[model samples]
Target chain A: MTSEQDPRPRAVIVACTDGPLLVRGEIDLISASGEAIPRTRKTVALCRCGVSTIKPFCDGSHKLVGFRTDPVPPADRKRDEGIVTGEEAPPDAERSGA
Target chain B: MVVCAGSQGVDDAPVRAHCVGMNAFDWARRSGGPPEILFDARGPLSAHLLDVLQRPVPESGEMLAALLPATEIALSQSVDVLRDDDIQLALFILYGLHYGQVLPADEDWEWNPSLITARLALEREFEKRLRSCVPMPALPEVDSDAVAGALFDLTAPDPGPSLSRYAAKRATPGQLLEFLVQRSIYTLKEADPHSWAIPRLTGRAKAAMVEIQADEYGGGLPERMHSTIFAGTMRHVGLDDRYGAYVDNVPALTLTSLNMMTMFGLNRRLRGAVAGHLAAFEMTSSIPNRLYGNGFRRLGYDTNVTWYFDEHVEADAVHEQIAGRDLAGSLAEDEPQLLSDIMFGASACLTIDGWVADDMLDAWSKGLSSLRVPLAVQSFATA
Candidate 1:
């Protein structure tokens, strides 16, 4: 969490369509109860499709579960840096921060 | 020792003398190593290729002369080229030349025109057969998300009599060893076939591939490399961990699985297919790996034996995303024309590997060994 003054390190989480949410950058993944998630790899796919046997981290269970987002095609998804995402984009000034 | 061992193709003495320059008999005696020669000739092409690798390649002119007849004979005789053990083995050996330690041939032989000619002759037939066999999937719009979505769908887990499920519940210890033996052909050389595509790609796609491969390669820890981890699992299961140790045991279909990747990877024209192949491969890996690990655990094996599969459970979770979106998907975004080939590559992987799995499961269900050679002895089993 960022202080009132200092900004949080911008972590981009892309909610991949019919798939897990891919979180990039240095992230301190944790549970709702504040338990820290152990991560070995830098970028992680968090289980948005709750059926993943491995909780928190995805093991690609979404396809079997038929996870879907909006019916809108990917062309409408906002582009951040180079990655096109299903989520809304940051403000133009914030996009320029990188 | 396994490096020098090509299983059965060429004569141990001459090939070793030619390649390693050791007194083959003495080295054999002192080391008590695995059989370190080219394979026993399975078919005409393989017989001819083994013969070529045995001889020094300055004799390529003569090698070429002898090879053409065999290549021509094999090509002419083949109907279902995919299952032709002779041609597949020949291709496997040819590609093995690029990955050192599998074939005991001199370095000069890799680029020898005659060998390339033979490999290409076989590959053209093999590629033709593959293209005919697996019709390409419908092309998605050339955007990263669209392409990635298509790849994800193509690779989604099947709801059927699956090999992983069979392994998890039914396979015996002997069957487990056979599983390792069948898998040894590819798992030992993990990430290598696809790594060939790294230099072929550029920008986000290339970077994405590099990212996934870096993890596959153990992130600078050589011992932790997926291939090394696989080798460790082999050692745990009391199987030979050395590369090509089990090449003799696997059937043509198993070789075809790897050979397909090599064909895709080695040819720049099929670069998109290779990317898609890796995506489908990674996409399909994690969940099955979980079941595969459970299969070994059901047999009462410890973590040492299952770590390779366990590692894949997490590693490929991350990899599938990169491979689906950043690699294959991004590659499609860059080269719109390659989108179709990319889908073909993914389908071909599922089709070929699906067949391989069915072969194993059917063999197991029949109470038989899946490997070409029934594991006659468990070397690590204390009698």
Candidate 2:
């Protein structure tokens, strides 16, 4: 498909063993202040903790602060189902068909 | 006006009110709240707002005028009131009435024809002024998918001192908390504003918005909800997290950012703008949030203080795609007419938000407070 016709969204989520999560390309980043970061050159990192030498991007701040993203237990984990089930009920009957 | 109408907190009310303007009964939310008399025509704006809202139907034009002085003023000025503190604050409050943030207005006014007329009239002027003042980015096509690309392009910030970069590197704890206070105006409301488009869209676009909003609402867990998470972050930093608690402390620029979103999301005609706005927003979020979290960490704050930013790092990475493709792209495919609007919305978000960020960073760089009233000026004893 041409770029315009492509419906599959693309993104890069890089997991760092001893540092911050490195992300690249089209992503939305709203700060705690509700401001959007204007587009940048397709690469960024997120600090897992408040402490990052890199400020906004993670420069291994989590390791210093001991941040952890423990994986959810098998049964409890929602398995990235691509959509949340039962969580979002439609508004009503009349507000259908857009 | 459907199942979701009742399933709301104060934040989501704007989404419900977006398609419709405030009616007489809806105006009651203004009474005895927030220092300023928000609506001021018949009684004080607040009192008249409540009086009209408690009624079952539309009030007279004079009554409507009392509750919507900002609207009247906006049309006459022809200047963008979206950033005017008085006008934006009042408009935000007016929209809040329809969202059912507090008690429901009188039942009869929910669909009052005359009240709707007044809202439409006000909105027309508000939008007209914005179009003239809010510079839009040059776009290639008016199609939905192309609109997404244009929006992405529009979100790019011009070179300078971005607040996130500064916060990460240099902000003091007190300064950081103050910044968070300005953000609380919208972050506390989180995804409710954008959710308004869910009912106004269909197919890919509708699904896309729901996909992103579901995460924003924190799936099923109330504590994990973005708004709830933000409140936790606020409490971590010793700021008040209750809704509208710090409304007075913020300046017009802060209020305008949200007013723009509400204005974009509430108007169905601007659905593409909402989508593009969201896309541009998400596309730019992940990195700065990381910096924000780190900035707090650098100040010796713990994970609790940074969870909001951390959460965005993960959530928005996923949301960016959902927003860009499913929401914006899908919308363009469904309604080709909105392509230019979508582009316009995204660019508007970037330009307006850039202006505010620059304002905050510039103030900090100059060693001045960014809030409307500086922190030192407010006496704790009286407050």
Question: For candidate 1, lDDT tens digit of each residue in B1-383?
Answer: 33443222233433333323232333444567633563466876787788778776766567568887789888899878888888888899899889876767777888877778888888899999999999688889889988888887676654467767666767777877777788778878888999988898899989999999998888888877888787767655555555565677789988998899999999999998999888888887876777778878887788888888888877888888888888988899888889989999999988888788778878888877788887656433321
**Candidate 2 ranges beyond 4 A from true positions:** A1-98, B1-70, B77-79, B102-115, B141-147, B376-383
Against the true structure, what is each candidate's TM-score? 0.84, 0.66
Superposed by TM-score, candidate 2 places the C-alpha of residue B206 at a distance from the truth, in angstroms, of: 0.9
Report the number of backbone clashes for model 2.
Answer: 29
Worst 10 residues of 1 chain B by lDDT: B2-11
Model 2 lDDT tens row, B1-383: 11212111223434433312233223333332322222232213334555566554544456765655534655466445556655555555556656643234554554566456546665676677667867877755645445545554454323345677677778876678678878877887788778877898888788768867876876767777887778767654545454555666677777777777877888898998888888877766765677777788887777887878877765665565557656777777778788778777776777677777777778887888888766532211110
Poorly placed runs, candidate 1 (over 4 Å): A1-11, A30-36, A71-98, B1-35, B378-383
Name the top lDDT candidate.
1
Candidate 2 per-residue lDDT over residues A6-80, each given as its tens digit:
876577675543235656557788778989865332345676656654456553224223343665466534433
lDDT of every predicted structure (CA atoms)? 0.75, 0.60
Q: Comparing only chain A of model 2 with the true chain A, what is the TM-score?
A: 0.46
